[model samples]
Target: MKPILTATVVAALVAIALPAVAQNASQIARVRGGASCAGCNLFQASLSGLEARGLNLSGARLRQADLSLTVMNRTRFSNADLRDVEAYGGVFSSSNFSGANLTNASFVGAYLQGARFSGATLTGVNFSGASLQRATGLTQSRLNQACGDEATQLPVGLSIPRC
Candidate 1:
């Protein structure tokens, strides 16, 4: 009886963990297959070096994900949670990130030409050497909440605090 009870508990724990694992796998599959996975649970996903253009991942959770060197041009990441993501050298030209939470994300040397950031939270985001010269919807107030290095390029009359 004790062995049976132990087995039941183990099975229950496995059942609880499987859903999260399966959900992550399914979300990764959908994104890799060029499907728009809105509001998907992609926490801590490793999607480095992928060149998926024009993806719609609005309201998705991409916290702690590895998006290094990815070319996600024109992707829609509006309202997405991108906290602590490592996106060094990623090309996100013309992507929409309005209302997204990008707290503490690293975008070092990223190309963000014409990206939109209306109402997005950029607290503690590392934009070292990132290009935002053509980005839109950024104001002094929004830039005040974020930090960047001297090499970080921004639109004229807009400056970012040094990280």
Candidate 2:
């Protein structure tokens, strides 16, 4: 009876730990797979300092993820859930962010030149010190929903609302 109880307790602990282990393994697999995390569930993951040019991250769940200082030029982030993400100092030049949920995301000191923001939800997004020069599909309504400082460089003919 004692051995059976111990075995059951061990099994219960293993079961409880398996999900976390699996999550970590999944993150590791995505990182190992050349930074292409399309349709991956990377919620609240710390992906800072990743240098992955042209990374395909479409439809990925990056809610509250830390993408600080990552260099992801021309990455595809269409339809990704990026709510409350912290992307400070990241370089995402020419990336496709169409239809992404960028609510409350911060891109402070990031370089986002020519990145597309079409159909993205930009409520409360912060672009402080970020560059969006020549970016496409940005509307005044969306810009109004976002916040930026004077250091935020916008596309020609487009202006940022007072932050």
Candidate 3:
């Protein structure tokens, strides 16, 4: 009976500690040069289903990160390194993405209306089912390069490019 009670206690403690241990996001934003991002390194972090509206993440490194279903309205990602990140179903309206590296990033089912992408490298990015109406620095040629799906919403008459 004593051994069983101890085992149960140990198991409970381990179960409680497991979630905290698993939620450690890699902090790697220790670079110089940026107004909003002075210090932060968030590589491959799991930010899925988080409500981070109006957050300042400028110049943050989030490569290969997961930001699915995250509400990022008015969020600032200017000059941030977001290569190969998964950000499907996020809200990025009125967000700033100037000079950001969004290579191979996917924004499926996201609301990116009024989002800015000026001077950003969007090579191999996917915007399938995402709304890009009124998004800055987003052109038809850019869309062609990124290759979105048929459900992607553009300004007008802008269909997804063929892969």
Candidate 4:
């Protein structure tokens, strides 16, 4: 009985020490089922290779999520929290990111043609090899807050610092 009590206490301590999963499983299921899950909590979600087009994820919390190779063309991510997301090789053409927080996010080799970035926070974002040639609502000030490699393609007369 004493040993069992000690084990229970140890398990409780371990659970407290670990970070809690803030994602909503039901919302994730909805997304998986090809449903739009606006304002959902998707923290640290692994959504690689997902091919959902026109997804409406506005106001969602997608911090530290993995979107590698995901084809979410024309998706809506307005006002979303996307900090530290990894979106390598993803196709997000014409997507909406207005008012989104993209701090420290990586978009290496991603396609973002004609996307909207109005009022989006681009601090420390890595756009290495990403294509944003026809993106809208981008200013020099916004680009200055982010970084890209020489292979990154932007609209004519606009450039970002090498990452």
| Cα-based lDDT for every prediction | 0.91, 0.86, 0.77, 0.93
- Report the lDDT tens digits of candidate 2 across residue range 29-123: 67545668788888887888888898888998888888999988999999999999999999999999999999999999999988999999999
Q: Look at candidate 1 and tell me the lDDT of residue 13.
A: 85
How do all the candidates rank in terms of TM-score, highest first?
4, 1, 2, 3
What does candidate 4's lDDT look like per residue over 1-163, in tens digits? 3445588889999999998778888888788777888999988888989999999999999999999999999999999999999999999999999999999999999999999999999999999999999999888999999999999999999999988
- Give the lDDT of residue 130 in candidate 1: 98
Model 2 lDDT on a 0 to 1 scale: 0.86
Clashes of 1: 0
What tens digits encode model 1's per-residue C-alpha lDDT throughout 1-163? 3445588889998898774542387898788777889999888888899899999999999989999999999999999999999999999999999999999999999999999999999888898999999999888998887888989999999999998
Lowest lDDT sum, 10 consecutive residues, model 3, at 29-38
* Model 4 spans > 4 angstroms off: 1-21
As for candidate 1, its clashing pairs are none
Candidate 4 colliding pairs: none
In candidate 2, stretches whose alpha carbon ends up further than 4 angstroms from where it belongs are: 1-24
- Please give, for residues 1-163, the per-residue lDDT of candidate 3 as tens digits: 3455588889998888774432223342222111233235667777787775676788777778888998778888999888999999988899998999999999888899999988888889889888997788776666667868778878875656843
What is candidate 4's local distance difference test score? Answer: 0.93
